[model samples]
Target: AEKGTDRSTLMDILWDVQRRKRYISEDDIGKIGQAFNMSKTELEGVITFYHFFSTTNRGKYTIYLNDSIVANQSGRKAIQRAFEEALGIKLGHVTPDNMFGLYRTPCIGLSDQEPSCLINFKPFTNLTRDRVFEIVTELKSGKRPSELCDIPKSIIHYTPAEERTVFFKPYRQFSSLSILNTYSPEEIIDLVKKSKLTGRGGAFFPTGLKWEFCRNNPSEIKYIICNADEGEPGTFKDRVLMEEHPELMIEGMIFAAYAVGASEGAIYLRAEYMYLRDRLEELLSKYRSQGYLGKGIKAKTPFDFDVYIHMGAGAYVCGEETALIHSMEGKRGEPGTREFFPVEKGFNDRPTIVNNVETLCAVPRILEMGISKYLSLGTKATPGTKLFSVSGDCSKPGMYEIEWGMKLRDFLDLIGAEDPCFILFNGFAGECLSEADFDREISGENLLAEHMQFRFKDPLEYARKMGGIGLRSGGSFMVFNKQRDLLKILKNVADFFVAESCGICVPCRTGNFLLNKKIDKLILGHAEQQDLDEIKEWSNIIKITSRCGLGKMSSTALNHAMLKFPEVFEKRISANTDFNKSFSLEGATADYDRIINEMTLDYD
Candidate 1:
C-alpha cells in the first residue's frame, strides 16, 4: 500500500503482490481495487489479459517452458517429460507438495538456445533431458533458480574486429550526452535525418521524422518510450542490446527527450525479461548519481529528463505503440484506434516518441560516429548496420551484426546454415522465403518501395515482377534444413498467432483460429484443394481487414510458404474426395471432450 495508488502503478503493485504471495487472491484484489477506486471486474480483466499473472496458487517455483518451434525442434518433448517425471505432476498443474507449477509459454527471446525455460522468470537455456532432471533435483534441494541459471552472458557471435559494426563496437560513457549542448534540437533531428536511420523494430519508419513530429507538437507534457518488449518469436536482438549496452540505449532515450522536449520517459520491458530489471534499475541509479539522469541532467541546459522501467506482463500485442501506452496507463494492453498517432496523444494523452531498443541504441553511436561515417556503412537507401538474431538449423545460432543489404545466401553461408531449404524471415508475422529467392537483398528500401507501389495489392506478384522477396525484416532470420517438416513449422506459426491474438477485431480473432484449424487438417492428411484455396482467401482477408500489425500480418508466413513452396501443401492434400471418408467425428470432438474431462476433474 505504500507504493501510492496511482493508476500507472497498478501493474507494479500487481506484480509485487504476485511475487510475494505467488498469486493474487480475492481479498488482495478487493483491497487493491478499493485503493485504486477500480471495480473487481475491471481489475480481473487486467489480470487475465496477461499470461504471467495468476489468480490461482502457482506454488513456490513457476516454470514457463518455451513453446517456440525452435524449442520443439531441439527436443523440447524430452525435456518436458523429464520435468513432468521429476515433479510428479503434468504441465498446467502444481505439485501436491505445493513446491512447483509448470506451464508452457511462447518464445522468451532465447530461441538461439532452444528447450529453455524461465524458472521464476530467471532464464535457464540450452536444456537437455538430463539437465532438466538435474535442475529439478537442485531446485528440490532448495537451490535458487538464479544461482543455477545457465543463461549465457552474451549470445552475440564473435566476429573479427573488422566485421564489428556500430553496436558491437567499443563504447565510451556519456560520449553523446557530452556534446548535447552544441546543437539545437532541430539540428539534432536534422543530423538523424541525414543518417537515414529507420526503426529497427521492423516498421522501418524514419526515426528522425517520428522525433520531428513529436517535437513539433505543442503539448506541455511529452513522453519518450523505449519499446523493450521483444515478444516476436525467433527475435532476440533487442534482448542482446539491453543486456550488453543498456546505457547506450538509455542515452539515446535522453537524446529523444532532448529532441522532443520531453521530461518523463520509460523503458517498457517485457515480463520475459524480468531478470534484466534489477541490473537496469541499478544502471539508472548509477546514471542519476553521475548526473547523467534526473533533474537538470549534467547541470547543462535547462532541459531535464528522467527514465523509469515499466514492466509488461506477457501480452504480445502490447509491443504495438498504442497498446504499449495503454498498458503503461494500467489498462488491458489493447491497441486503440489510430485517429491520432502516439506522438500527438499518448501516455495520459500527451505527445510521445516510441523507439525500439536497437533503434535507440544506435542513436548515441550515430552522434558519436557522425553522419558520413554511419551512412557509409550500409546502403544509400538504408544506412547503418542491423542486428540479426540467427537461430534454427544454424551452426552459429546467435546475434549477428551486418550491413543492411547482405544477401540471404551470404548470410546463410556466414551462419553455417546446414542445407537450408526454408527461412522464416522477420518472424511468424513476417514472410517466408525459399531457396529460389536466396539472391534477394535484406534492406528496408526494397520493402518500403514495394509497399508504396503495391499498397495492399498482391505481394506474390510484386515478388515475381521484382525478382525479389521485397520484405523488410525486424531481424529474426530463422533457417530450416531440408530434414525438417514445413507442415509442422507452419502449424507452429499458426498456433503462435492463435495464441497471441488480442481478439479485438473479428478478422484476426476468427482468422487465426480458422487458419490453425486448416493447418491441423493438412497435418492429419484430411485437407483438400478447396481447403488450400480457402486458406489463401482467409489469409488475404486477415491481412487487409485486421486492425493492428499483429492481426494484419498474422498470416504472412502461411501466405509466403504457400506461394514459395506449393509442393509442400500439394503433397498434404487428401486423395479421398468423400467428406465422410476424410472427416472423422471422433477427431473433431476430441478437443471438446478433453476440455469437459479436465473441467469435471477440477470439479471433483
Candidate 2:
C-alpha cells in the first residue's frame, strides 16, 4: 500500500505486483483495477502492451534470451538449445517443476556482447553453450542469478584519455550545479545554443531551441523527462551513461528544472534496465541527503526540484515522446497525433521537455567545461562528441566517443572492422550504407540536408543525384562483414519491427506485418521482380502514411538495403512468376496441425 493508488502510480504498482507474484494473476489485476478505478479490459490492455509484463505464471526464475540478428550471428541458437537441454523445457514453456521459464525477447541493449539473456532481469552476457549449462545448474542449486552475474561494465574503446573524454572525465560533485547558480534561465539556454548541441537520441533536434520553447511556455507546472527508454536495438551507449555517470544526468535534469521552472522530473527507464533501478534510487537518495537535490538545492537558489525514477514495462514505441507521456500516465503506450508538441501539451497537459540520456548527460559537462571547450570538440555544425554503441564484425565491439565529421571509412578503421561490407548507421529504423558510401562524413549538416530532400522526393533518386549516400547516425554503428547474409539480417530486422509495432494505426500495424512476409518471400527465393516493385510500393505507403516514427521508419533499412545492394535481392529472385507454384500447402497448415495435436493430447 506504500505505492499510492493514483493513476499516475499504476506502472510502479504493477511492477511491484509482477515482482512479488512473478506474474499478475486475475485476482491481483481485479484488486489493482478496483483500487486504481480502471476497468479489467483497460488493465489487461496495459499489461499486454508491454513485453515484460505477463498475466500467466512465468515460473520462479524467468529467462528472456536475446534473439536479435547479432545474437543469432554469435551462435544464439546453440546457446538456446543448451538452455533448453539443461532446463528440460522447450522455448516459451515453463519446466514441469515450475522452477524455470524460457522465452525469447528482442535486443536488451547488449549487442556488443551478443548471446545474452536477462535471468530475472539481471544481464548475463557473452554466453557460450557451456556457460548456459553452468547457469542452469547454478540456478537449480539455489544460487541467485544476481550473485552469479556481475554488473556489466561499459566496454568503451577507441577513445582518448579520460580527461579529454566529455562523459568519462573526472567529475567534481555539483560542479555544474554551482555554475548554475551564476546564470539566469535565459543565459543557460543561450550557452547551450552557442554550444550547438543537438539531441543525441536520433531526432537531432537543437537542444537549446527545445529548452527555449519549453521555457517560453506559459504553463506554471513544467516537466523535465529524461528519455531513458533506450529500446533501439544495437544501441547501449545510454545504458553505459546511466550506469557509470548517472550523477551527470541527474545534475543535467536539475539544470533543466531550474531553466524551465519545473518542480518535478522523472527518468523513464526501460524495463530492460530494471537491474539499475536500485542503484539509481540510492544515488537519488544520496543527492537528497547532500543537498544536491530536493527543495532549495544547496540552499543558494530559489529552485525547488526533485526527480524520481519511473520504470517502463517494455514498449519500443514508448521511446517516442508522446507515447512515453501516455505510458507515464498509466495508459497504453500509444503515440498521439501531435496537434501540439510536448513542450506545449505533455505529461498530463503540462509543458514538458523530453531529452534523451545522452542529451541530458552532456548538459552538465557543457556547463562545467564551458561553451568554447565543448564547441571545440566536434565540427562547427555539430559540436561535442557523441557516444556510439559499436558492434558486429568488429575487433572491438563496444562504446566509442566519436566526434562529428569523422568519415565512415575512418571509423571502420578505428573500430578494426573486419572486411566491412554493409553498415547499419543507426538501429533498424535508421539508414543502411554500403562500402561505396565510406567517404561520407558523419555530421549533422548532411543529415539535415538529407531530411529536407527526402521529405518531398525519393531517397534513392536523391542519392543517385547526389552521387552517393549521406551519413547520419543515432549513435548505433553496426558493421557487417562480407560473410554476413544481408537478406537474413533484413529478415531479422523485419521481424523486430513486426513484434514491436504498437498497432495504434493501420499503416504501422499492417505495413510491418506485410513487409515481414515480403522479406520472407525474398529470403526463400520465391520473390520475382514484381515482388521487389511491390516491396518498394509498400515501403512508400508505410513511410508516408504511418502515424509515428516506428511505422514510418520500419521499412527504412529494407528500403536502403534494396538500393545499396540490388545484387543481393536480384540473385534471390526466382525466374518463375506463378504465385501458385511458390505457395506451400504443408507450410501453411503447419500451425493448424500443431494446434489440433495439442488439443487431442489434452483431451486424452
Candidate 3:
C-alpha cells in the first residue's frame, strides 16, 4: 500500500480487488486488513454497507436497472422485464451460465433522460423495450459497453445557448485555467465572500466562510472535496456539469485547493457516473502534463494540488458532507453530529473543505473574473446563476441555467412546460408546489401580458409572494402536469424517503417507513382521519428528532401534498361502506412503489 493509503482507501482497494477477481476473497480481505493495519471485522463491516462491493462472486457483468420515480414514470418496469426475458434470468440473481447479475438500483441522476440502467456503472439512458433487447443481444455476442450503443447526448441547456452562461460557456469552449496568482489565501477568500456564493447542494452555506474556516484550521495535512454524489431523485445538474463541463468543475476544485492551501482533493462521485470516470481521469492527466496539477505547476508558486475521483456505491445520504467523508473512508455512509464538522476534523481527522460540484465550479470563475462581474448576474443575497435539472411534463426537459430569482411562472413558460399543474422545486426530499398554491400564477406573464417581463424590486419578496422558499432550490425543478396524479406523486416521493433512510437513527429509519405505510393506507382506501393525524405527528417527530438532514426534510413532499391537495387524499379515503376501492393505488403509482411498498420486506 502507498503511504497515503489508510482505512479511507479501503473502498478503492476493494473495488480493485473485486475488479481483478470478480469478488474480494477472504485471503484478499485479510491481506488488505494487514496492509491498512485494520481488523478483519472492521473491513467486513465497511464492505457490507455498500451494495456495489461484494465478498462473493457477483458475476462477469453486473446490470443495475434504475428503479426510481422517474424511471418508473418512463417505463423502466417493461424495460426490466425485457432484460430478464432476454437474459433468461430473474433480477437479483446471476444467469445459469454465470455471465450476468441483474439488480435494482436507486436513482442514478438521469431523471431527465430515464428510464436508465447501468451495465457495470456505464449508463445507458432513454431506455425502451427494443433497446433492452438489442443490448442483451449484443452482450450475448460479447460486445463491450461502448460498443453496445452510443451514450446519450449531454443534457445541457433547454433554452438557447446564447443566454445560458457567463463563464462556463466560453471557458468550456476555449479557456484553460489561468491559475490566478495575484492574491494570498485570505485575499482569495475575500473575493469569494464578495461574490456572495453559496453551496448549491441545498444547505446554501456561504462558500467564502467555509473556505476561510478550512484555511484557518491549521493542520499538517488537509483536503478538499468536490461533492458530486447527486443521488436526489429529481436532481441531475451535477451530472450535466461533470459530463459537459468537466474542465470548469475541475478548475473550481483546483481553485479551492489553492485557496485553502491544500494539495489533495477528491471528487466523491456517485457510482452511476462510472462512465465519466475515464474521461475525467484523462482530463486530469492532461492537466498534470500541462503543468497544472503537480508540485509548483505555477512559476514561483509553492502550491501543490492534485485530486482523486472516488465512486460511491448508491447511498443518497452520502450527499451530506460528513457522511460523504465516512463513505470515502470505506465505512457506512451515515452522517454524524455537526459538533465536529468536516472543516475541523474530517477524512481521517484532518481539516477538510467540502463544496458542491456547482460551488466548486464557480470558484475559479469568481477568481478569474472580478467578484463584481460574478455578483452582477444574480440577486442581492443570492448571487450568480443556478442550474436546474428540469424533467417531468415539460417540452424542453433538460438542464437549464438561469440567473437566480427568476419568476416561477416565467421559468415554467421558458422551459415550455405544458399545462403546468405543479412543480417539485427540488428532489424527493424537497418541496412541491402547484398552480393551486396561494399565489398560483405569479410568473408575471399572467400578471400582465404573455410576453412581459416579471420585474420585482426584490426576488426573495417575489418568491414569498408567489409561493414559499422553493425559488432557492439546490437546482432540481421537476414540472408535473395536470394529467399527473398528485396522490401517486406524493406516494412516490414518500416511498423514496422510505427506501433511502440511512437506518442510523430511528426517527428517520422507522418514521419514514411508517410515513410510507400511512400513505399506502390512504391509497388503499383504508384510512380514517386518524391516519392523517398520526402521519402528521410522525412527520414532526422525524423532522425534529432525526440525526441528519435526509430525515429532517424527508416529509416535505408528503406534508406539502396533504396540505395543498387535501381533496386528493380525501377522495381515496374509505367510503361509508366496508368495500375498499383504491387499488388504483397499485396501478396509478410508479413501478417503484411496488418494490418499496411491499409489506413483506421488513427493515430494522
Candidate 4:
C-alpha cells in the first residue's frame, strides 16, 4: 500500500470482506487501508468508532422485537414472555441451533400497530406470543406456515437496492452470518460508512456522520440519547417500536453508546407511554441480570454503558432534542438556540448524540448489510428503509417501512388511496398538502440536494412543483379525505398553536392570540383585506423571531394551508353561515369568571 494514494472503492473492499470464511474476509481491512492511504490498524480504528458493523456470522432467521409503550399497552410483554418460554431461550440471545435470534428495538412509534415482530426482515404487526410461536414452529418444521392471522400486507419493502432490484429472487441464502451479531464500534462505523443510513427522525442527519462527530469530539464524557416521545399530533411511529421490540431498540442504544464512547443513555418516552416505561424497566432488569448492561457490557468489554427511561409530561415541544434534554434534566420543556451543536454540549454539559427510535434501530441492519448495501436501497441521498406512521384518511393507515425514493402516488396506491384526499407530511397537526407539490420523492436528504421546495403559490401548482419532503424530519405521511373541512382544520390548528405558545416569546403569545381573533372575524363574515394583511404580518413576524424551531415553524402550518387553500377559509365565512360558530366573546367572560372564582379563597 502506498502512503500517497490508491484507486480502490469501498465496494471492492466490502466484497473482499464478504468473500472470507464462508462469509467475508478480514482482508477487506487491508483493502480499505490501501484505499484510505492508512495502515490496516488505522482503518480498523475508524471502523470501531461507530455501531453499525458486524464481525461474526449470525443466524439466517433474525427476529427483531420492538418493546415500547404502544405495543406493551397493547400487551407485547406477555407475547415476548410467551416467545421466550416457547423457544426456551432468553430475550436477547440467539439459539445454539441458529434457528433464530431475538433482539428488542426501541419504539418505532407505530402506536396503532399492535404488538409486532419483524419476520425475515418483513414487519408482522398485530401479533401475540402464540402467533410468534406458531410462525417459529412452522419455520423450524420446514413447513410453510398456515394462513395464521390477519397481518395486513404492505408493498413497502425495506431491503438494500441490489436486493430490491434483483428480480430473480433466488431462495434466500439462510446463513447464520446474514443475521446481525454483536458488533464493535469500529465495525458499526464501517458498516454505516457503507450503508449511508441517515436518521429517521425529522431532521434526517447522517447516522454515520453524527457518530463521527461525537467520536472525534474532545470530550471526556459523551452522551447519546434516544428520543422516544411521540407527541406530534398525528405521529406515533416511535411508540409502536417501543412496545413491539424494546430490546431491538436496546441493542440499537447499546450500539450507539459504544459508537460515541458514551457511558449512559436514556429513552425519553412521553407520559402517555406508561406501559412502555414499565416494559422497558422489566427488560432493563433482565439485561442487567445477564450482565449485558452496567459497568462492563459484552463479556468484560472495556466499553461501559447503561440505558434508562425518562417519561415526559406530554408536551409537543419536547419532541425537539434540546427541549427533551432540558426536560430530562427535570426542567420545563423548551427549546434553546442551536448555537453550540449538541455534539459539543449535551447531557450534563457533555458532548451528546440524540437520535430518534427508528434511526438507531436501523443500526444493526446497516451493520449486517454493509454501507453499500444500505446505500443501494433508497434514493441516492436518502439511503436505507424508513418507518412511517400513516394516519388520517387513508385506508389501512398504520406504520409502514418503505424505501425513501418511493412516490406519493405509489404510497397512496400501496395504502389504497383510491379516493382523493389531502396529503400531510409530518402530521395532520403539522402541514396539510392540497396539491401534489409534496407528491415528489419522500427522502429529505435527496430533496435537500434538489433544494427545499417550501413556498407554494396555489394547490394545483403545488402538486406539480412538489418534489418531496426531506426524510430528515422523520419522514411522516398523513392523508386527509375530502370529507374534512380545510378551513375548520386550519382554525383548529391555529387555536392549538396559540394555546401552546408557552408564553415565553411575546410575539408568539400575543400575535397568535390576535391571529386567532382575526381568523374568527374572517370566519364570522366580517373580515377585510386589511385584516388578512395584519394576520399575515403578525404570523410572519412570529415566524421570524421565535426562540425555537417549534415557535418559528408553528405559523407555517396555517400559513402554508392558507396559501394552498385560501378558498376554504373564504368559503367558510359565508353570510349564511352561523357567525356564533366563530367565537364566544360573551362565553369567554363567564369562563374567566369561573376561573377567577375557583382561585378565590374564603376567610373561613
> CA lDDT of each candidate?
0.85, 0.84, 0.75, 0.60
Q: Cα deviation in Å at residue 59, candidate 2?
A: 1.0
lDDT of 4 at 477: 64
Positional deviation of residue 212's Cα in model 1 after best superposition, in angstroms: 0.5
Candidate 4, residues 53-138: lDDT per residue as tens digits?
Answer: 23443345555565533344457788788778877778876678766666665443343565766543345677766677788787
Candidate 1 residues 83-183, lDDT tens each?
99999999999998778999999999998888789999999988888888899899989999999997555457634345337898678777778868787
The TM-score values for the models, in the order shown, are 0.92, 0.92, 0.87, 0.63
- Give the Cα-based TM-score of candidate 1 against the true structure: 0.92
Give lDDT for model 4.
0.60
- When sorted by lDDT, best at the front, the candidate numbers are 1, 2, 3, 4
Position 353, candidate 3: lDDT: 87
In the range 72-95, model 3's lDDT, one tens digit per residue, is 778988988998898888888888
Model 1 segments beyond 4 Å from truth? 158-164, 447-472, 574-604
Against the true structure, candidate 1 has what lDDT?
0.85
Residues 381-486, candidate 2, lDDT per residue (tens digit)? Answer: 7777878998899898998987767787888899999999988888888889898888887776653347523242443244334221233345887889999999
Clashing pairs in 1: none
How many pairs collide in each candidate, listed in order?
Answer: 0, 0, 1, 67
